[model samples]
Target: MDNKKDFLKQIMNDTGKGIKGYMKAQVTLMIITFIILGIGLTIIGAKHPILISAGIAILDIIPVLGAGIVMIPWAVINFIIGNKDMGADLATLYVILVILRQFIEPKIVGKEIGVRPLYTFIATILGSIILGPIGIILGPLAAVIISSIMKTKKKTDNRR
Candidate 1:
């Protein structure tokens, strides 16, 4: 009974750590995104650069809507008003934002979760492919869970 309790406790602690790792990754990504968007908007001479960056960062937290929700409409509005240069710049910024997310997400997420970044990246991509949009989050999470379980099992086996 005591051994079982210890085992359970260990697993629980590992899970807690995993959760923290995920949180760290999420916060890091969000900060990086906000900084990049803020700097880009400032460089482009957009009015209220800080407000736009803040808005983008907040929007990024929503899995369904994302930055595109605001950017796409903004882009279109600029085009309609015949501000082609601004519209094009906005579109380009959006593209860069997306590309950066794709490249950094797996590495940062995986680093926090105790898995190799490459494996995490592959898992994320595969998850996205198999499960659609939600897969990105689910994939890395699943990997972390599985890896933690395996670590627990190995420790148990060694004790025996």
Candidate 2:
């Protein structure tokens, strides 16, 4: 029927618009996340510049463990080399990084996922548990999708 065709066309248009909006939001959030992460890493590097920078860069790819993975090893190396002062400083920097990761990273990730803080935490844990490192990335994405579905359903119900 002509009406059915028109409805389908309208739906396609709306979907296109939504996809565009979502992509824009994602890019914006990614930029913000990078900025925040850069600032945090910069602060960590202020004291033990070389070690922290190298560690953070190396762990950049890993999901939850991230820079902590690199930083811990770097600290151990420092200790083994008999640089106790540097090792202690690196340890302090690692602690800062961990705190930032636990408290701040979630907030940044939540903004990117467009989900609530609680949901983000739950998704991260559930996702990591089921999927390992990859799960961390997928978890937030899935949460966003689920949230979007719920929101659309609510809108439809309201109209009805």
Candidate 3:
């Protein structure tokens, strides 16, 4: 019984570490996204790319809503005023940001936890769908917790 308890404690500790790793990865992705957008906008001839990027990134950090908060309206205004090129650029940036978060985040996070990426991706998507913007963060974490619990249970059963 003591050995079993110790094993469970170890599993819990590993799970905590894994969760921390994923949160770190998420923040890293956010910062990287901001930097990429800032540089990209500057390259594309936008004024004050740094400020724009900073605002977008801060909005992106907010739950559910993302850079889209700034990008969508700005794009629309540009298009309405006949600056189609700038509007298109803004739209493209938004798409790229989403793609970067969706694709890269799961792979790196799953690798951090030593599990299959598919499940993590599924969790992320489902989380977004179920919980809105915050779901993306929560979903992956919930999956990790569930995964850790199942893994521990399996190990304990095997020993039994």
TM per candidate comes to: 0.87, 0.68, 0.82
Error (Å) of candidate 3 at residue 80 is 1.7
Q: Which one wins on TM-score?
A: 1
lDDT of 1 by residue, 24-141 (tens): 9988988888998899899888999888898888788666458899888998999999999889989999899999998998788888988889889887778889888898777877
lDDT of 1: 0.84
Indicate the residue-level lDDT of 38 in model 1.
94
Better of 2 and 3 by TM-score: 3
lDDT of 3 by residue, 1-160 (tens): 9877876787778778877888677677668877988888997799999988877877776765777788889889999999999999988988888887777767887887655689888987899899987798788788777887788778878987
Q: What does candidate 2's lDDT look like per residue over 1-160, in tens digits? A: 9555654555555444544544554455434434444565566454555454544554555676666676678779988999876677767766765665577556765664467778888887899999998887777667766776666656556766
lDDT of each: 0.84, 0.63, 0.81
Off by over 4 Å in 1: 1-4, 129-131
Q: Name the runs in model 3 displaced over 4 angstroms.
A: 1-8
lDDT pick, better of 1 and 2 = 1
Residue 123, model 1: Cα distance from true site in angstroms: 3.2
